[model samples]
Target: MAHEGKADEQLFQLLANLLHQVESLTNQEEVELRTKIEALGLEVTKVPSKSLKQLDELEIAKELDKLSEKLDNVDEMISSAMAADPQVQSLLSDTADIWMPVITASADERRNFTPSVGENSETEANCES
Candidate 1:
């Protein structure tokens, strides 16, 4: 169906944009944090600590592994819960089917939601000005 295709396209774009925006914001935050760290005189090379560890590639890989393990635990918990209760399983299934569209719709709604546009005449006048 054309409607389903359009919805799928919107969902895909939403996910892609989300990933891009998150990465961009995360990079900005990393830059700010690094600046703060440098200001604090805690540069990795300057700091003298016996237990100091640089976040190198291997460390990042290990962290990724831990993240994967945590996700697996989450999946296991979900599967276990679904197995324990048919009603939960059904509800989850329904949520998966219904919430996807609701998520897109709610996102659109929030994006359109405006402030300083109520029935208050003074507030509307200030906003317009």
Candidate 2:
């Protein structure tokens, strides 16, 4: 039971870490992209995940999921935003190649991740009991 809670906590921490990484790349790299992302309403930070309640964990999970959907459609968003505003098109053209790939790769890695063998075994044992 405790392990399950720990696992949930770990999942929340991982989601928050992803959020922080996105912020770090966008925050320092391109203000334009940052502006686009900030409009999505993510409030994640460097909070210590261990101290948060389970409900907070659920909220973080939902927010991260929401952010992922928008991120997955980034190219389309860029295209539409660029079409709508010529100024942003020029700005995006300058830096879109710089940090977007890193963010995408990070998201891919997160999506394709498999839990460690030990973690799976532990979870299985917990379930069997």
- Which one wins on TM-score? 1
Find the 10 residues in a row with the least total lDDT in model 1.
36-45
Question: Model 1 over residues 40-78: C-alpha lDDT tens digits?
Answer: 233212434475767889988998898679658647866
**How well does each candidate superpose onto the true structure, as a TM-score?**
0.35, 0.32
Candidate 2 per-residue C-alpha lDDT over 26-112 given as tens digits, one digit per residue, 9 for 90 to 100: 564455655555543233222345844465778889988987886678768768867966755654554444334424445345344
Question: What is the TM-score (0 to 1) of candidate 1?
Answer: 0.35
Instruction: Report the error of model 1 at residue 68, Å.
Output: 0.7
Best by lDDT: 2
Candidate 1 ranges with C-alpha deviation above 4 Å: 1-54, 97-129
The predictions' CA RMSDs to the true structure, in order, are 18.4, 14.9
Per-residue error for 110 in candidate 1, Å, reads: 14
